[model samples]
Target: MELEIYQVDAFAEEVFSGNPAAVIPLYEWLSDELMQHIAEENNLSETAFFVRKGEYFELRWFTPETEVDLCGHATLASAHVIYEFLDYTDQAVVFETKSGRLFVDRDNGRYSMDFPAWGVREIQVTERVSDALGVRPDLLFMGKRDMMAVFEDEQTVRDLKPDFAKVVQLDGVCMICTAPGLDYDFVSRTFVPEEGILEDPVTGSAHCTLVPYWAARLGKDSLIAYQASRRGGVLECANLGDRVKIAGQAVTYMKGTITL
Candidate 1:
């Protein structure tokens, strides 16, 4: 069997400005071992696989190391592949993932995704966290992926030099150091050494937590967010009822076929 694959950079207008995700639209569900092997070979932070199932598609995400329950940028990239390459002309596309039913809207030169709003809970910072980050946070919170650390300013968040080895043991998928941006409304940087990614270029999942937190703090429902990764990512965020809509751009870098 020949399987088609697409490599897309999600959340950036340019080809390589955002996080890269491999979108593999599969004809059928392959064995878990094979999927893992494919992802390992790809060596990307996340590889998305999807199979059409009626009106929706069953989507799954895998890292080079293991499968994950949810991935935001990869999901966005999958939507981009379906719209741009799979001949999907509709204005909207829906993907039924392990997390839940995710919907993507394509319009006005941007792609918007309605994803689950992961409610974050406030927590106290410990010596371990302080030592790992090499700095102190004014406020700390817990989310699905990582511990949310609110810094004094954008510089503090950008200046973070966390001990990745220790951060891997602290907890969650990654550590988010965020503050109000000087240019944009908010800025964040995610560190996920545990997920085999040192710094996720632009983490949409992290914004699920950041959007709500900043929305409540800033008393606004909409925001412009910037991820301070080396590659960088820009996102327009909005908080909905029990859901968060993250919008960004995706550019296809490579597309090819894989013989299976």
Candidate 2:
């Protein structure tokens, strides 16, 4: 079988700067095992597979190890492929996903995605978290699938060199470290060693949790955020009551065919 594949750098103004995701569009669903093999071979943080379903698309995301419930950068990358390569002319695209209905809108060259807002609650800072991150957090919180460690400054979040082995032993699928940004409204770094991603660049989904917390803390509905990964990316964020809007630019990095 031959499948067309696109590699897109999401939340980036240029290639090699943001989170890279492999996107494959299908006419029909492939076997789950085959899709997992494809994602493992691609070896990016997340690979997105989608099938057009009338006015909307059914989308799924996989890491090298497992399928995830939600992924932000890959969804944006998939929408970029549909609009730029698949000749989609719609102003917005809807997706039926594991997380529920997702919407992506194109305005100018930027793609804005509407995602569910994940609420977080304060949690005790455990020795496991502190030892994994090599520093103690000012505050710690738990979300649905991730745990957040709030720091006092952006530099602390950026300078962190965590023990991924220890992070893998933590409570959630991902360990998020964030702080108030000097240039932007907030800055974050996400580690998902448990999901085979040691660190995620320009995580859009993590912002779902980040945006709501920061918006309430800062008393603002809209904010700018930066993911302080080695290959960093910026996000324009808005915290709605039950949802969040994440906007960013994506660029095509490579296009090719996958043979199986």
Candidate 3:
């Protein structure tokens, strides 16, 4: 079978600036093994596959090693494919995912994603956490699927060189290191060696947990954020009552055919 595939730089205004996700739109679901193989072959942080289901679409995300419950960058990339490549005219697209129904809206050349906010509880920092990050954060919070480590400043977040070998042993999807930003409201860096992504340049899902944390801490509902990875990315963020809005621009990097 020959399938159409697209590579999009999510949360970036141009190529080589944001997290790259592989998106494949399917008429029907393919075998899980095959999809996993495809994602492994693509070798991106996440590969998104979708099948049209009436007015909505069913979406799944896979890393090089495993399928995940939620992924923000890939979902944004999928919406980009639908709106820009598939000739979708609607202002927004809703995707049914393992996490739940995710909504992406397009306006003024930016895509805003409405995703569920994850609740957090304070966690005592352990030796493993310090060993993994090589820097101890002032505060630690545990979310449903990820951990938030709050540092004192942006430079600390940018200078971190994680011990991925140790980080992979932590019991979470990824370790999020964040600090107050100089230009934006906050900044972060994500490490997920177990998911085959050492550092995600831009993470939309991480912001779901971040938006709420920062909003309550900073006393604001709307804020701007930056991911301080090497490639870097910017996001316009907002914290709703139970949901968070992550807004950014995506650019098409490549379009090709996948043969199986």
Itemize residue pairs with steric clashes in candidate 1.
145-173
Worst 10 residues of 3 by lDDT: 83-92
**Which run of 10 residues does model 2 get worst, by summed lDDT?**
165-174
TM-score, cand. 2 vs. native: 0.99
Candidate scoring better on lDDT of 2 and 3: 2
lDDT on C-alpha atoms for all candidate structures: 0.90, 0.96, 0.94
Instruction: Estimate candidate 1's alpha-carbon lDDT, on a 0 to 1 scale.
Output: 0.90
> Which clashing pairs does model 2 show?
none
Tell me each candidate's TM-score: 0.97, 0.99, 0.99
How many steric overlaps does candidate 1 have? 1
Cα lDDT of model 3 by residue, 1-260, tens digit = 99999999999998999999999999999999999999999999999999999889999999999999999999999999999988898878999999999999999779999999988899998889999999888999999899999999999999999899999998788899999999999999999998899998899999889999999999999999999999999999999979999999999999999988
lDDT of 2 by residue, 114-192 (tens): 9999999999998998999999999999998899999999999999999998999989788999999999999999999
Enumerate clash totals for all models, in the order shown: 1, 0, 0
Candidate 2 segments exceeding 4 Å error: none
